[model samples]
Target: MASAARPQGFTDDIVQRRVHRQRDQFLQCITKEKVLAIASSRRPGLSCDYFKDPERGSYNLCCFVAFEDGQRWVIRIPLAPCLAWGARSKLEREIATMQFIADKATIPLPKVYAYQLGDGLDPLSSFVILEYVDGRPLSATEVDSLSVDERARLYELLADVYIQLRRHIPFHRLFDDLEGLRPSEIQARYGQRGVLSSATEYTTMLLNLSDNALSNTRSRILDQEQGDDVLYHHHLFRRFVKEDWLDKRLDDGPFVRVHGDLQPFNCMVDERMEITSVLDWEWSRVVPVQYFQPPLWFTGHSTEFLALGYPYLRYLERLDEFLRIMRELEVQKYGDDLLSQEWEHQKSSGGFLVANALENWTDIDRFSTRHINRVWFRGTKDAPKRIETFIREDPTRRDLVERLCRAHEIYKKELQQLDGTSDPGDSATTPDPFPRRPFFGTWESSVPGIITTTLALGSLIIAITFGVWKKRNL
Candidate 1:
């Protein structure tokens, strides 16, 4: 007998169909009719027939169920084998966390109607029933057509959410109880389940998470040079943390729950200059205040382009404006503006780099390119030379890097085997930090520079040819 094959990812049409099929299955017992049975469980006698088309995200597939009683609810079905601690457990945690936030914080969140309870939801044991938020996600190109003032107001609204998540959440009581959980379980849920004594402990836990993410081969596409990146990345993060460049007096106290993926995509905004509801609470966790910074959507591009020019410059202007809004909101709310005090480091280059270290630890190549290659060395052109100089220039840094390399490689290999991946035979692996991009193959990240250089060379050739033609005519 042959076993069924697994999906490459949820992106495939077949996998998406299966997800839709699963939602359909939840509607009824194929053998029996349970259409009303499902809705009644959420709310007694609330009949539902029309289900909106499924909306898919990286981790979950959601379908909006509209009841005849003018009620709408969403069924969030977890994609199994989901990244980090499996899908079922992660979804359960998200449900618990969302419930906690809704009760404690004044933030607008979708209510969880039925999860891990009720025999009516037996078919959807793997899914959660949530209240459907009415609004559009700001990242859905809806905010682009907004007027300048509208955009400013939008940033202010977003800053309010950030302030609410940090300020209003009753995390102190939760931390005091600590869930009666073991230190490992506590650490699993929150970064500093115990109070972080120093920067090293905090950053080391970040690296550990990155290593765990890498150990899971399913989290990323198999890159041959993946292991090489850890040496430089781990070294730079630690060194910067030790110096005042990163984690400056920010650890040891007052850790709060951060909306881990606090971007426009996860935030739903209405036309009335109000943020209706914030979504994607799965990755949210309690961490040091410094980890929470301005959202990435403010950067204006997918890749973090620290280089000056078209989009990066716009990001700087928007970022300052956003921070100004946050400062004002903090003052009004707490009268202390303590949250603004920590973000002073966030405006620095070291802050952004260290931030990438904490957040993008799972994706080391991205951290290297955006934080180190782009920001530190300027661009791809100077990356190799600058990186070599950086490692070799300082003896202490060099020793630290060597230790990181050995540790990263050994752990990566052990985890690789655990992921059922054999040695990739990467003896021929190049020291190149950045991998081959999709469209351009080996094309440089500096596209504007390439275009400008091409035009300059074309002009030079035309001048030389014209001069030769004049000499021949003479």
Candidate 2:
């Protein structure tokens, strides 16, 4: 069967072109002889053909260099924009993570042959050469197509990998150690420190992506409605940050080394359905153990798809089986029930709730308050009461609540308009209620200038206030 055509607005043409241009420039910097020399240590007299991977990644471009003898290697070039945005150190961190896992864990990963940062011959290029594993990414359709026995076998393989990953002890500090790499040098290269220890620190780091840094630097031509959307998200996030109850819960666990990006596409499997390799460890970090849950792709539904109609419910049987398998594995390894512990902790801490909230903030429909309350506050009736105190005490909290209410009203009106329904409440059942919008076309037209100006002013005020507070505290 042929792959379905990607929906409009789903393509990353600009990023793709940038990646291809960088690939071409890096290829130009070296001759066939130079390429042969780089691989000569592993494969003598290695003449090769190079082709870029058709499936493009967000930050790196992968190219296959196949030798005449049928041996293949993968060269991953960090895209120029990514490097400029401090991804060189991220790449280095990934290399360090792979090396550490190779030494400490039983999980299979690509063997890194060589890595290079900009030098005299190619001052702007950075790439990693690794042994190529011949396997395809396991898709949701592929998972559904598998036999029951085959799916079980695949789950076992994945479970073994997960167990090993979790069993490996976390580093005392959050940062991975790359030999001969200085902390200052790493910070200089990345424009920020690499390490994180506490949950507050980790949450702050993730929040920074939505903060003034990206908002101010992002192209002004982006959709105006996006500003209001962002403000709405910030309002939700501020609750998590300001409420001591939420912050303490967020900060309530021991750090564990986690494969932060473990979506299905990152895992490779051969015809036998055994995991051949796991790719992309750039975002791996020492985070709280509460984050070390099952892969989000197990349900075979994206968050966007979930917002449409809770489509993941169609895979409920499979999800149940997957959870059973995980629970059995966890019991065998740790002599405790995984799901029960996770559920108990989630109820008390709302860790997963807050995480899902953060991850799906941009798509509020997917992370609605009703869903969060059902999942995280199932047995507790004091949910509103818990936040009630914060709303009463903090003027900022009250302001955010008002902003959130106003934003939701606007969102409902937009949904009603799209659905062609007079009653906004009826919009939920409207077919294809929220068609995907282009990234640059996400801003609202009415209040773009006002939102931008307000954000800038607010950011400046916060910066000044922080400076004064720090000085006085010191």
Candidate 3:
């Protein structure tokens, strides 16, 4: 293949600015007396069809070059400054981990050529030189573009990949802290009897934290106080949930690696309809022995203006099928009984969204465009007219849904009983109580006390005044 010329116009300056940092990082990682600077040729026929803003601006700018010796390689320069808070170091370590897995693991992950931490163009920038796999990102469009049998075959191949990865790479060894420990030793240290045990613990902690955070945020909103603590707790909870959930549920299991950002778009299918390559390991982590079902965007809307096809629901269905296959595989490997046990544990621990405060839920209904808030039954014309229409048409589903809604209403009334019952007189206060320290922690840590104390003191003058204030505002 002939080497293409440099891309034109404004893009030229951007490339020129980033090139120095790319080369610098390369030199730093691989100290060679002599280095060959690959030409920056713009590869045609591909575009980044990213729906969301690529976080950290870590998009790769590369030109596919087939050298005179008929060697095909991609020279990729990653943009974005090294984040101040040691994220660059974390990323560098991750790159090393990926290289280690590629070389040692049974699975065929990306082969890394070189990783360099750069300076000049984008200081704290990093560049990775890798062997470019020839394929397109996977999505419903790409899957539908293939024959039905081909799609099934691709999924089967992916399932096999998961099985092999889980079997070969034990979860404890994949993460930090246990990098040097033998799997058995690490398991002993964590008191994890097996992969499932660790996963259950991790998932349970994260969900509980999320529940507490959401509960606190709801309380603050109800009291009409814009306390920074409430907002901070919510943010912290979201972060913890994302990290812990990934670690325990996805990263802990050797079976399914949480391909952190997998949503079909990061997958690629070759001419043979096989997944040629999985792209973007930026968010990739070892996960539970399940198929990929990564989260979607907040609004979960697709950009129609972009020429690339968008089939959101179809992609979700495909993902669900993939997860189902993994679940079946896990059941086959262990027992259907074990899978059921793990699932039941997950439910009891609130691994899934169980309850929502009526007020908070109403806010979501009024605000969110995400599918979770999709209307099941509403008289509004603004949203999609499906659930109501379905209820109007189907007798059984409508009746069952109505019964469920009534039950939910009853639950709501039951919750209100404890709203104003707190009485501090039940416990005496001590004098000079350490001069009340400055409040500076998260809502998760504080809101529980606030709610409890507020209710307990409702008979007091202060509590009565606050209640009157709320009523007056109402």
Candidate 4:
């Protein structure tokens, strides 16, 4: 009998459901005795009632332990499957980042009491015990409803945090430690970890997604041996990857340690509107200073507000004011020249905006037209000419030109179908067809499996091509 067919695409629902099951199993394994033991270590002779919080993050399960003395603590467990490729390293880094911030900065952050890096034997074995912060997340309504004074105060507080964070300089050699560990030790400690050393490395990782997509398509084409579908997909991704102008701008930078996922949801504010704790440090990395200029959540709202009938113009106005205050504060502390230098780069190349868009692509409402056009076709009316130049640079890539043109037509048709319009040209202002909701879902869920498959194929091709070139030269 034939085996059951595997699903072709990774669905958001499937990922979420699987993650949910893992969370449940982990929770079930955490007995009352274990919670009591963890809590008693912090507070001697303490017994507490523990319950899972309804509010859970994508990568963590939160369990609240209430002591008889009315004190509370949170037990956070890392959901392994929910994490991307390197779960162990990410978990360790997060612990290190939190500890570093707690020691070095005055920024509000949860104090970790104890943690266990679980071996894969048991689901609930890994856990982090932290002081339960008393505050709620800043809601979207609050963001939209904040008065001028409140917003100004919030921005100032955030700026202070950034200033303090900047004082803690990144390692000279990317993720290397100040302890002077050996190269092998460093590799074992940090290699394949999420910590990036430079802006160029970050950009390459982002662009490599497209390269991988193309590779996958090429492989599938070779495997089945006769499909234009994969070739057309490859052309589209290749065009995106070959945006050399944008690539060049990302290569220059003054690197700094960044809170890689600093958004409204990751921050907790008290009823009095003060930031209580900044949570989730898993995505933190060393990156260019310009990357920290635009607020992650603000830039992510470029098209989202338009879809929700919110006044995007008002949003932009508030955003400008927020940025202006932050810049003035940065200038005052770091001197006019240091801050101005980064701002100049941002204005000259539009690199800051492009970088912000790239990092927050998953949150972006319209990925293709808004992000791709804004970055690659900025100030230029002749985007086709730029694409033609890319094609002309390599005779081997010339075959992709027609395929790319054909892919664009297909893309237009897909857009038209989503917009319910017969004329694709007239539907430019339509709402985003692929809005990623519930923010926790992986980008892989939204993207088709074929894209991932193409990426693997592309890597293989590069390796083979390099081998051939070396053989010929030798």
- Model 1 per-residue lDDT tens digits across residues 6-65: 212112222233344443443333111242355567676666754644554445556667
- List the candidate 4 regions with Cα displacement exceeding 4 Å: 1-24, 31-33, 51-54, 85-87, 176-198, 213-253, 299-316, 331-337, 340-350, 360-368, 371-474
TM-scores of all predicted structures: 0.64, 0.62, 0.43, 0.64
Give per-residue CA lDDT, model 3, range 99-201, as digits (tens): 5456545454556655555454432255555666766555544455666677667766676554544454445522322111122333453453433334444
53-114, model 2: which lDDT tens digit per residue?
32234455555678888878876665443233333554556676777778788788888877
* Pairs that clash in candidate 1: none
What is candidate 4's lDDT per residue for 1-474, written digit by digit as tens? 011122222122323334445545544565556657766876788667765432345456566788888877877766565544224444566677776667677888887777766567464567777788877766544665778788788878776777666655544434421111112232343346535555565555554543333332221222211222333323443355345324445455556667765667667888878888887776666655545554534434633333222343444555567657767877787775344344444543333444544443322223333344455555235544554554556765545434544554564465446467565443332332222235432111112121111122101000011222223211
lDDT of each: 0.50, 0.50, 0.36, 0.49
lDDT of 1 at 333: 74
What local lDDT does model 1 show for residue 11? 25
Clash count in backbone of candidate 4: 7
Alpha-carbon lDDT of model 1: 0.50
How much lDDT does candidate 4 score? 0.49
> Which stretch of 10 consecutive residues in model 4 shows the poorest summed lDDT?
456-465
Off by over 4 Å in 3: 1-59, 82-91, 104-106, 118-125, 144-146, 173-256, 286-474
Candidate 2: stretches off by over 4 Å? 1-37, 50-56, 68-70, 85-88, 119-125, 172-197, 213-230, 240-252, 307-317, 338-340, 343-353, 356-474
Which regions of candidate 1 are displaced past 4 Å?
1-36, 44-46, 83-88, 117-123, 140-144, 170-199, 211-230, 307-313, 366-474
